[model samples]
Target: MTYDLYIGDRMFSSWSLRGWLMFERFGIPARTQPVGLYSGTMKQDLEPLAPARLVPVMRTPEGTVIGDTLAMAETLAERHPDAGFWPVDPEARALARWLVAEMHSGFTALRGDCPMQLHSGYTDFTPSDAVCADLARIEELWSLARTRHGPEGPWLFGAYSLADVFYAPVAARIAGYGLPVGDRAAAYVARHLADPAFRRWRALGLTKSYDPMPYAMAVTHGPWPGPAPRKARAVDTGPSENTACPFSGKPVADFLELDGRVFGFCNPACRDKTVNDPEAWPAFMALL
Candidate 1:
């Protein structure tokens, strides 16, 4: 069908992740493109992206471009009904749509406070009451779906469907941050945390630039205590050792922090690990 999908860093691009999962899970043929986010150039960078400050934009051979995660997924599923992107049962499909939509429009408090950061390293930052309330609401929503739809499958409404894709990023955060959740939600997360598509996406997320720093980079890179300063011991090195790759912990210029910028990314996603935990960042420099 000649589909081209644009995405952001796997670490921080939650919306993009959902759309990408749909394409991957269904084995759809598509080309993937990355746009940097923390480079202090989102508006400029996305100028060519056509009408938006977002990622995960999809374009078809017919010259139609679709924005927004759910909108894009729905469009693709419609064209490839045989692909079975949505649920087959009328009742189940309806419920799935409702949940997916709920995710799209609601969760303002959580979205504002937590913000999604796949690579952001966890800091001891405390979430606000509003944010916590949002989390609680989200948990309740997930709990209801599984309870009412558990018989269908292990997924929200049973089986891996669009609803799960819509909530995929949230699910990732719940697992990564170890957020407060109920038993059912926790079980669902355990299974989802192990999903092939999700794993593959996260694995790759650890590989791309998030444009801004991703929380994941914090997982591997840090204010590396560059070797304990030579204690007046015979001067050792002519030149200091090079910094390591933030994402893989490998020494490479490909993952660099310029001038000790806190949020700058070798790849935006890598930076997510740091940005997610602002408290962990010394607030002395700006990556963007």
Candidate 2:
């Protein structure tokens, strides 16, 4: 009785990752279908699940269509009570729900500026006042949850819950953008990064090519911390060289492989530029 899960590009789709984790972390087996998020087929791809015009849409084993992460989370939790999707304690469960709801509704500024990009971290990208305020609120929410229930473990509520799953992408954005966050927040981000499931999600996403990278930022600080996990070797990059991608002037390490040769790009967007119009790109042309 495997459920069908529809998601977008794993690398850039933050909510998609959140939906996937709700199932993966809890041992709920699901079959995933990748909807074309960047390929401009998102609307067409979602026709099968009408009224669900977004990624992370799901169809239950009984063929009930569910949209939105919150509804999906609740349905999954109800169906698999033994899986422990929520915390055991009543208080902790309520708090977890609060945190997840807040995350779903709040943090507009942070999401706008730093969309979850596991590709690399931005260097010295300063946050606006609004963004800082959002980060502080997030820290406050995380701290409250931890103070009440984290004595037992690294996760909020003392054990992994939907709260962690919901905020996982926010943590990724914070780490990816090198945003200023408190030690507790940083630790939380580190924990999320170290999760095997997250690493696998990122690794699998990197295997695909991105055309017109989403939310390409200027003035990148550097690649996000941590060496590429062994599983993501196929997508992991090497050190940068003196030469840069002509399109975005990013280091050589962030290159795309096409044909038998490699082409340097600052981000997938830049790479797609070359791919779409090879004659216009001398740098890529020279590689031939």
Instruction: Give the best candidate by TM-score.
Output: 2
For 113-148, candidate 1 gives per-residue lDDT tens digits of 565665433434466787678778888877777767
Candidate 2 minimal-lDDT segment of 10 residues:
226-235
**What TM-score does prediction 2 earn?**
0.79
- List CA RMSD, all candidates: 11.0, 10.8
- Candidate 1 at residue 279, lDDT? 24
Tell me model 1's lDDT, rounded to 2 decimals. 0.64
lDDT of 2 by residue, 86-190 (tens): 999899899999999999998999999888888887878899999999999999989999999876668987788899999999999888888899998898889
Q: Kindly report the root-mean-square deviation of model 1 from the true structure over all alpha carbons.
A: 11.0
- Name the regions of candidate 1 deviating beyond 4 angstroms: 120-125, 209-288
What TM-score does model 1 achieve against the real structure?
Answer: 0.69
